[model samples]
Target: MRKIIHVDMDAFFAQVEMRDNPHLQGKAIVVGGNPEERGVVATCSYEARKYGIHSAMPCRTAKQLCPYVQFVRPRFEVYKSVSTQIGEIFKRYTDKVEFLSLDEAFLDVTENKKNMASATYIAREIKSAIWNELYLTGSAGVSYNKFLAKVASDYEKPNGLTVITPDKTQALLDHLPIGKFFLVGKVTAEELKKIGVHYGRDLRNLELSYLVSVFKKRGYLLYDFARGIDEREVECSRVRKSIGAETTFNEDLPLNSEAARQVLKALAEEVSMRVKGRGVWGKNLTLKVKFSDFSQITRSMMTSYPIVEAKDILIYVEQLLNKVDNLDEKVRLLGITLSHLLTDEERLQENISLFEYMESLR
Candidate 1:
């Protein structure tokens, strides 16, 4: 059996803020944008969660929920630096680390550098190191596969560790809520509930054919997960196929209006930041628009050269926007996606910045 450990930082962004400013500890705080500007909550402290605050919640709503809750702008660079430190700690035990995000990762320590026999022990030591060395706490889960390990890690939170051994897997899963199953989102959970599948035991009682008929492609994974069967590997180097950022507006704006253009520019900046952060570049730019009626359309352009900067991305975005026939439509959402990605290694061959390439064109 493979030994996997999933580590997730506890309210990572908020925790980091609290760590830096001692007065913020044990108080309700969030890391995000301004409430008046339709900004969303990126993460909230545990105390803030008591007031029904959560990630992706609008800052205005979070404020309404807890009027005194503190809001701080995101410091992504600082978070990345801390994440690098945490990654170094992971490398001390295992090189088979798969980062899901800056705040969470899965480590396959089946054959670890530390030669630790117990996966649980390794997880405990990792948690301790993060707390003692970094002044931050993390939750860890140990199991034989990625699914269970991830689930176990979430079972407890804000500095807790749980282990799912072979013998205890079935019992724990059988009682697990269907909504709690990995990959089962809100809509899927409601659908399963309608079919009398409220728990893993209920899910397992149904025939595979029935699930497939109901959920189509997703049914297969649900059936396997219900029975504690996952064959996925802990990929050390997972390739991200695309990087994108989007925003949904509180009020719709005319598609061709200046306000829409500004939103698009903001999205381009975000996409550019994320792409550069990953040390990759893209050759394709896709513009996604959702109208007031909830109808959506996407326009894509493939370029001969790498697109890396906000200015370059916006140039293509303007072209894509102009291509749309319904420029007068009121749009509720705008998104930008960069695909046909080239990794850091592949990018070295070109060895030229997008700015320099643009200058050559000039």
Candidate 2:
């Protein structure tokens, strides 16, 4: 059996805000946008959740539910920075890290850099390092596969660490509600209930052919999940297609001016730093602009030579920025992305097919 660990940041966006501002500690904080502007909650603290606040809920409703709740605009740049720090910590233990999102990932530590046999120990150490160095809490779940590891991590909330050993995997799956299964949304759960598949054991009872006829691809996945079997590997061989940095301003910038150019220059510098750090260069440069109205546009230019320096990036980015025809529109977000990348070292590698392996499980 392989060893996999899923690490999820606790209330990522809101938690980052709270960490930076001590006064927000223990207070109900919701990070997204203003309630007056038809904003919605991106994510809220546990305290805010008590008031029936949740991600994707409208900010106006959140305020109505709890009058004193604080709503703040998201600072994505800060969140990205924190995510990078956490990623560095993960790389210390294993190179087989698959980022599910900015806040969560699956790490295959079957053969880890630390030479530690216990995946559970690595999970604990990672959690400790994040807390000590970044002052942020993360939950980890260890199992033989990605599905179980993800479920185990979410079994408990903030700062949770759960391990589902091979022996105990079946028992846990049988008792776990169908709704609790990863990727089972509300509609799917309701449909499952109609078929008397309310739990993992219920799901296990369904015929695979019948499942395939009804749910197609997802059916095969659910059947395997019911049996505590997931053949998917932690895909660490993925390559970065592009590297970019963006900034959303508190105030919108007027079009065709030094303010926009200055912002682009700063973003180019940051993107260049990241590109150089990765020992990679790009042949295409793109400038992304989001207007105050939220509609966005991207202008890109391909160069004969790879861009590795900030000065070269800035030149192309500035040229692309000038190509924007809607100068009358107020720009609220500015970004620069370098694409058509060439890395110093190959990030891609081959893994055995999961389908054949999965057939053995059935």
Candidate that scores best on lDDT:
1
Put down candidate 1 lDDT per residue, 1-362, tens digits, no spaces.
89999999999989999999999999999887678865667789999999999876667899999999999987777887898899999999988998776788999999999888999999999999999999999999999999999989999997989999989988999999998898798778998899798999999999999889988977898889988999889888776789888888999999999889877866776676566555568989999999999999999999667888778999999889888999998999999999988865676666567557878998
Per-residue lDDT for 120-149 in model 2, tens only?
Answer: 999999999999999999999999999999
- The whole-model lDDT of each prediction reads 0.87, 0.83
In candidate 1 the C-alpha lDDT for residue 63 amounts to 98
Model 1 bad stretches (over 4 Å)? 213-216, 243-285, 289-296, 302-319, 329-362
Count of backbone collisions in candidate 2: 0
Cα RMSD of all models vs. native, in order, equals 4.0, 12.7
Q: Give all TM-scores, in the order shown.
A: 0.81, 0.67
Candidate 2's C-alpha runs over 4 A off are 237-362
**Worst lDDT 10-window in candidate 1:** 270-279
